[model samples]
Target: MSLRLRLNLLVAALNLGFLGALTWLLIDNHRNSIQEEIEAAHRVTVQMLGSAAQTSPVFGPAPVVMVNFLQSLGRVRANDIRLYTADGVLRYSSPPSAYKAGRTAPDWFGGLMRSTVEATVIGLPGARIEIVPDASRAVLDAWDSMTAIFLLGLGFVAMLHVALLLFLRRLLRPTEADARRLVATTQELAENREVMRLIEAGIEQERKRLARELHDELGQSVTAIRLIATSISRSSEAPGVTQGAGKVNEIAAGLYDSVHRIVRELRPAVLEQPDLAAALADLGREWRIRNPDIDLSMVLEGDLGDLGEELTLAVFRCVQEALTNVLKHAGATRVRLAVAQREDRLEAIIEDDGQGEPNALAGSGHGLVGMRERVATLGGSLETGMRPEGGFRVSIVLPLAGDSQ
Candidate 1:
């Protein structure tokens, strides 16, 4: 059930329980009150008749005097009176009450409030007077009063329940404008992520094209220059000519090496072989050679070679960007790069022992932005901050295809 419905049901149940308990209490109190009132009225009537009966013989014939006395008397409240002669004649009886004359409480209600007081009989010389306790009128009054009170209580409870539900709906329900804004923001984010993914794919394709062009064009031209210089140096006899040709060969060789390195950086062998471990190893080896002053440590775990091309490239690029930042800005002497693949995700951390800038990650740097976009496109997350123990840290986590949305 919805929370609102559950709350409404709970409130209704509580209201009903309260009404039930209140009604029960009122019934008990009214029943007891009727019993006490009837009993008291019966007691007074019996005592009055007993005293009058004792004095009846002094005045006249007991039956005749008592009959006259009862005729003068009217119906007593909550009690009935009767006069009977010694020969079993019914001389007089109390008239029905004119107060609320046409009405009586229900039998079940009357039975509930009926008093336990018995009829009292007073004997004279030739007659007897009987007074019986009556509580029907009182019960009827109680029933009417209780019904009014219950109806009032029910109305109040119903109103309170409706008010509470209205309040809850107003408090819990989101505004239409806010809901629309949220939807728009979510769609914008999704569109931006998709665009970033497409752009990254296009950039990689361009890099591959460039790498192939440089390898086939610049690389072959440099090799040809080196081979021609070697042939010229072998064919020349003069020391000066031989030495100049030798210099040309050396320059051509250096140009060839530079072109090959650029091609490799643009499109690594790993892209074709899909071996992340070997790619990282080659990168680390070249970094060590280029920057002998800095110590770089790399740790790989799990089967990184099996990670898909996109994931592998994303991780590699992020690490490369982080290392480049460390080299250019961090002035780091030691860097530790670790990439691990777990059951359903990949985690990479790059930490550098250097003078880390606290605001480095927050800056509008393309490298950091690119890294974040790459990881986000792969259903991953990136974190960058200064380490507590000193230096900067970059952390990345990518969910595997099965683990991703």
Candidate 2:
């Protein structure tokens, strides 16, 4: 249902409940007033009857004057009176009559009034005079007042509802404009996200292409030059020429190694498929060779074959950067590397027993910044701190990817 209709229904329900409560309270007050009036009249009637009997004992002596007097009062107008004999038989009563000049209320109205036998009896030992209170006129007056109040209240609530409903409609008019703007903004954001995805994919493809070209063309050319230099140095024994050719061969070998390293850095081979663990082990082995003094211990866990290329690359880059920092800045002897996967998350920790600054990449080092970004892209977290036990620690946590195999 529409909001407007729902609000209207709620208001209507609340008003109806209020009206019902008010009606009950009014009816209750009227009933209480009737009770008080009847009780008061009963007290007075009892006193009058007692006084009459004290003056002359009509019940005992069968006084003709008192009986005729009571009959005369009954004929004109009397409270609801009934005289019962000692044997439990009705002897006399007030004549049937209307409450007002010519109107008597219906049975429902009578039922709505207070009960009848709530009044008391007043008489001698052999006689019973039941004083049935007659408050029908008062009851009718109360009913009339309640009906007027209800009609007035209902009309007022109707006008109030109409005014408030109109006000709400006017107030909500600007919301439609905001809703349209929100929809447009959401669509723009989605389009931008798709564009970013395409750009990222293109960049990855370009890196792969470049790595292939460097490995195939430049790498092969450098290898041939090194081979020819090696052959010339081995055959020719002229001391000066042999020394020069050896130097040339050594420089060529260095260039080839540099090219190979650059190609691997540009596009990691292990990231093409899953096998992230294998890639990490290879990285550790390389680092061990480079930093022989720094005792490197690797603890790799979990099958990383489920991780996607992007996630694997990101994590691998983080590990690579961390190791570079350790080699460059941290003058430590022992470096520990750990990568583990448990359930839906992958975690890697690298700590070195070196005197490295905790805030090394606070406002410096593009490498560390790039690492942080890479992990963040996959909804992961990175933490760096200096351990109290005398070491610098780098921690990384990443969400594991779905099945990519």
Across 150-204, the per-residue lDDT of candidate 1 in tens digits comes to 9999999999999999999998898999899999998888888788878999999
Superposed Cα deviation of residue 18, candidate 2 (Å): 5.2
**Which stretches of candidate 2 lie above 4 Å from their native place?**
1-28, 47-80, 85-89, 93-128, 132-174, 274-277, 287-303, 306-405
* TM-score, every prediction: 0.66, 0.61
- CA shift at 112, candidate 1, in angstroms? 17
Per-residue lDDT for 63-94 in model 2, tens only?
Answer: 33345546776632224777776677777776
> Scored by CA lDDT, what does every candidate get?
0.89, 0.76
Residue 395 displacement (Å), model 1: 1.5
Root-mean-square deviation of each candidate, in angstroms?
6.5, 7.1
